[model samples]
Target: MATSRIRERSPKRDSLDDLELPEDYVPYVPLAKRRAQKYQKLIHKKAGLDFGSNYEDGSGSGYDSNDNYRRKNKDQNDSGRDADEDDDEDKQPLTGPQAGISLIEQSVELRKAQLSAEEQKTDVQKAMEEEAKILAAVAERKQLASAEEISKGIVYKDPIKTTWTPPRHIRAMSEEELAATRLKYHIDADGEDMPPVIKAFRDMKFPKPVLDYLKNKGIKMPTPIQMQGLPVALSGRDMIGIAFTGSGKTLSFTLPLVMRALEEETKMPLAKGEGPIGMIVCPSRELARQTYEGFVGIADMLHKGGFAQLKVLLCMGGINMQEQASVFHGGLHIVVATPGRLQDMLNKKKFNLDLCTYMCMDEADRMLDMGFEEEVRTILSYFKHQRQTILYSATMPKKIQDFARSALVKPVTVNVGRAGAANLDVIQEVEYVKQEAKIVYLLECLQKTPPPVLIFAENKNDVDDIQEYLLLKGVETVAIHGSKTQEEREYAINAFKSYQKDVLVATDVASKGLDFAEIHHVILFDMPKEIEDYVHRIGRTGRSGKTGIATTFINMNSSEQILLDLKHLLKEAKQKVPPVLEALEDPMEKYREMGAAGGCGYCGGLGHRVTECPKLEQQQKTKNSGMSRPSERAGNEM
Candidate 1:
């Protein structure tokens, strides 16, 4: 099929030399390309004008043609040939008129060409200066945006490295000097005792405006934690505070935040939702809102004193995302946020942390407990310098300490009481009862106790059931849990707070950071699984120098170790350990020492409930006969 083309031997005259030009074909010329041939050809046929030795012989400027005659008119296109004629005219300089440029402009150009080493700069240096100017313009715009956001309850961030000078009110001090301050505050650093703590805010060297705010708030003396933490934070050092709830821990961190932000406002540009000088993240919505109120309180005082134009924003769930984000668009300076809401803002690029100099985590231990460590770390990464990261918690477990090692820098720890120990002021009582009897026992507690009782349950279902049962028992009750809408939860909390409800039943959502003022008693229908939670639960009562009671319902189902730990704590706090706790003897020294939940202690069966074990009925029969089995003697001996 391909033979005709391959076998053809006769050739037509179709070579490139014989190919006819197309009627419209034009040679391709590169962009801005000047054809030298066009310039070489003489366009004027009359005469070629000669400009003499201003362009020298063989200097490459004279026109060259088909002939060379040394210094003569060598070009064939020249009107005539004469060697001396062009040169004699060239030796005389030709004075000509120039363009109408001003003398000043000409002088300016001359100076630029002759600039001295000190006056001249490299292109990179010039470019850098121009870039800096552009950045300054951007930062100014951001600062204006942030200030506007602040007026509308939004928190704005600014460029991380503002041109403002760092606050230097804190005198430079060595670790030794700081140690003395720590010792005064009873701060612990790795096994070393800190320096003496300050007795008053004045002694801690707070600015006058802050001192005035404290005085107005009736805080004449600093609490143990505040005495220690404020100094460390003011020094711009990371601080870890392990204190009981209601020990005024909020003030410890908030005071420093306000002061630092006030100082920074004097320095740089800020943007809405961009570079809030202070960021306080909470684990839940209630805490975020509460903390925001606390911050705003202080901010108001400072604002009145002309110390700073401070604004605080509460970022939480169950609210309009646009509303929350819109506040940030105004002029937010301080942000109190839950992990999820803040992380979402960060992901959307609507908020920035470029210039956040202060960061505090309220109930940081609880945040990690709720599985928000990754979010917290992501927030931390947004910070260019975690200048003074502070973590305040009711309990600081080993996990929190490890987290602190990475999250904070050279943190001075202030432990108000024994670390993670329940508050000493709360009188804790434990009762033994089966699950079926819990409602009756709770009723008994209600009958005896006064109003404003806060009873905690393990889950939402328990909270609802208990709340309903209390209502049926002729008790005024309100309930709140994680599942409720934010408005409903607020209504419930407000009802409880205002004494319209005698009792408030809740899940763990109400446990941390929400100050239910003057809660007379905290009853736990179900004990918390973690020791830290138990500490926080009991802390709800016995706050602000007042004593309260915390009673727990215990049964065989409770973790055995937890029971022992509670018992020991009860004794240590000088509270009465009930007979039920004392009568329960340890199963065996072997199990106690080995820390193993060995096979059923009651029936000696490998896999059975204590009540359902088959050996239980036999043991009961033997016990009814009043004759001790040999196996019993062996068991007692073992």
Candidate 2:
């Protein structure tokens, strides 16, 4: 009703006859409001006039109108005026305060003072700069002279050529020693211990040339993975080798592939589609290149004594595709390639897989995690069923299992430590930190270690942001991610590897493939999305038996499951678990310990079932109060 009244009171035009129209006048537009403020009035003196005389009350002749008006009041104030004062005042001409000089003159003087100060400041600054430069130059000259003097006294020596001294005097490890070694590596083997752990490569009965190559490369004995996995991979059977990263997983697959390739006869002028005899697929270009180099080195060693030289081709898409295709165009013994690039080539019909008798997928879990399973499947379609297939991954998930079922024949599953477990040598530590405090915590962690730190972020933007922030904090940093060009990524990796860059911030792109020998620490700036990624990111450090540290920044709320899983993983691996993780593990146990029986499920009430829920206590009070309020009505009805 109020809204209707308001609407009824509002004016509405009923006819056009009363509307006003412009007839003969121009409409005037309002001017914009001025923003300038009015200031105090500045008194100005009239030129050629005395400033003192302008304010004086002077006696005048009777003919003057002003003198006539003053005559009436002059007699009334005559008693207060003195003859001496009037004489002195008339003679003094009413002098007041002396006025300041013209503003132009004052401004000019102030500007001159400022200019003088500025010039002095500049001179002092310039002198200081020159003095600093001279001092620096003098110090540098002294350093150079000292360096020259040292250089003059220094003697250059050739690199020491040391001969291998077999420990003839030393005895082989006893049973205790062997057991400790196995436990240290957490070696899990399933075979009959055939091709038993030999102390020397010659004992393995490898080709004499292959033994020579191993001897020259300083491989006196094989790593545990190489020792266990070699037998299964070499027996002409499909295999799944699960090992920690950088635990010689590369060599485990490469050595067997090389051995198999050497046993097979080399086909001269490999057919147009048929390329290398063995094809190794990696998830990233770096891994592919490393695998290619390994094959090349082994082939170089085997070339002597009737063994044919192996020509390995690296197939990755960063470089010219024509160059990659050119390698396939010609005959090659081995092909190392990333899965995506290899699939692209296969789709183009640039290569054939019929002759690829030996196939190995390094970092198979990583390859599938990157959504390349379809491409891997497509590549496998071209392969003949008779070829040997070996899948090597750090972790084996259900997808990998399914893939293995379809791809391999009854394969031997070899596991070192637990699958998806970090290196035992790496000390994993996690801190429950807020998102805002991550960078500060990361900085603190960086300070805890020496140079060559591998810091992992969740994405490319975070990597760049952390790197830039570290740079601003007076630390030199480099970053790598998928968004960067191949050249930039290589440069960053190389810089970090060469120790030219002390700190490296990156996404998971650098997680699996590139291995830095001296990386003393790995920091997860943010928790990875998947548990498998956490394994890979921190696996960068503590490689090859060298102990390293890995610190992960996790939020208590966001990283509950991750921390719980990590706690279990670390606990299983015999690592130190933090108290925060200990406290967060199994919150449901607290409810069980309270002795609550059959907690209500319908309304989520505690301590009792929904039928006799103690949570109804407040409703009972409301019901009693309602009943009390109706006593008078009940009395009236009675």
Candidate 3:
């Protein structure tokens, strides 16, 4: 083998000269030479220099021989730098010949100048400039009247007036007395020149008809939310009202909205297709319909009091779009609509918000939770002039606050209790039941309370299954979900409300903003994924100061975080916490002992830190993944 290796050692071959090649094969050019040729051609084309014979022959020597090209293009590469330096001294645009240039050429030059100027700026300078641009845009928008406002004869220059005056007795109260009233009601008001809390319905200066309606409805006293929220809303100030559910939040905004509409109608009779001075945006169709009915009742009262009939329309999905559109032609004084259907109508030119200056977002937190934030913004854009916006919610999470900051200007914040706190009027009961045994245990739990019970499940399928199981067991039951037709949902709701059905099984769609009368019991078939939902679910009972009971079933499948939150909520409300929940370790125990901030500031959920908030994390993931699909959890109530 050694002798064979030493036989012959040929010199290393150079290039392809040592190999036999095909006769038709063209010699390969070196990569550097090929790149040089391409660059030479590009330079010649940009400089408007002709490619001489040398370049045509593939030598690429034409660029060096052109003395005139070199002389003319010597400083062309530095032109942008020179222009940027000149701009630092003088910010004026070029005039004379430059001004006479074609639009295309001028645009190019302007873009170039902008790019050059931007390149020379530091990060701080760029930030300042961007902020200045945004402020200027906002100022410009504020100064200009929208086309809709102009068409409605609204002048942008006129300032919004606070026409609601407190009654003589209320005005006679000293400042200390007013503060004491707020303190007594646990009312916390924050803003510049906050309105004083109203002590009674009489202090709100409601029209006699409204006062009579309240008396007839047996609303003899103002709830805590009404005590503070009514004054803030009636004062024509944008407001964020946070109070526990069933704290009269609906009346706080609805009464003011109706009053404002009545005032506008008195000033100028509504012509066909020319009204809706007040608009209320709700998250679910059921809530929208309920609100519409409430509006109609108030409108009837106003008509009976010798005022023009206030035409109210319910705009929501499932109803015939044509039917809703037909009502718009008769002139609507107030509209209660779900965000999706309202935006659809506005997009179809079925209606406009030109005259709508009073806007209320009921269950504002739920609207945001249902992925209607963008749709809400789109609806707001349709408003022609500044509106007095009122956002009412049982919870004021950071997301809602951020939305408020963007939507309202100089808004007063009214909180009747700590945001997201459960209702003390509800007697909470927690039970441990295996997942497979939940159905059997559900019937047993129903015996704890009487008829007119509300049962909440987390999913639509569960709702249907529960309803069927109850019906099979000889229990009168009704069900509603997003899958139900509009007529079916309405009938089910009315039947339940009228006591035709002893039990109502539903998803989260019915959990929010639906006021059921005399609901003696609320049962959660399974623990909710979020603690906020649990609060709203139990809120079905214990409405309007009536004490009620809420029973929740939890098993191994329930998340520890949710269990921890449930435990804390029970403790906060002085309800009994189950031993199963008490035995679970708190992940934040050490952090709390270290005096670190407790719970999530973003959502007020006691189970997790802000960084570990599931809602926030899911939102971030959705944003990062560029997801555009609406959440299915919003249910069929859209």
Q: Using lDDT, give the best candidate's number.
A: 3
Q: Between 2 and 3, whose TM-score is larger? A: 3
Least lDDT summed over 10 consecutive residues: which range in candidate 3? 137-146
Off by over 4 Å in 3: 1-159, 324-326, 628-634
Model 2 agreement with the true structure over 1-638: per-residue lDDT tens digits = 99999999977889965767555322321222110100000122223332221111222221243545344334323533332343444344222222224558768989999888778764435444454454343222111111333345532222111121223322254646645555665666543322233334554446787777777755677777776576556665566788887777887778767765565535354545555678888877666766787777788888865787666777886767665555555566677888667877777777677677678888876665454555666676676435667788777653354446445555667777667767888888878789888887777898878988999987667888999999999887999777677778778877887888889998776787566777889999987745667888888888877888999887754545455556667776688878877776453344355543322332222222333322234334544665321221111111
Better of 1 and 3 by lDDT: 3
Residue 584 Cα positional deviation in candidate 1, in Å, after optimal superposition = 3.6
Instruction: Residues 434-530, candidate 1: write the lDDT tens digits.
Output: 9999987898887656889999987778888998888888889998876677788888888888899899998777788788767879999987755
Off by over 4 Å in 2: 1-186, 190-200, 207-218, 265-273, 303-307, 324-330, 587-638
Provide C-alpha RMSD values for all models, in order.
26.4, 34.7, 18.1
Supply the TM-score for candidate 2. Answer: 0.60
Choose 1 or 3, whichever is better by TM-score: 3
Task: For candidate 1, give the lDDT of residue 105.
Answer: 85
Pairs with backbone N, CA or C atoms under 3 Å apart (clashes), candidate 3: 482-636
Per residue, candidate 3 scores C-alpha lDDT tens digits across 136-206 of 43222221223445456553332256678887777778889988988888988888767777878877878
The predicted structure with the larger TM-score, 1 or 2, is 1
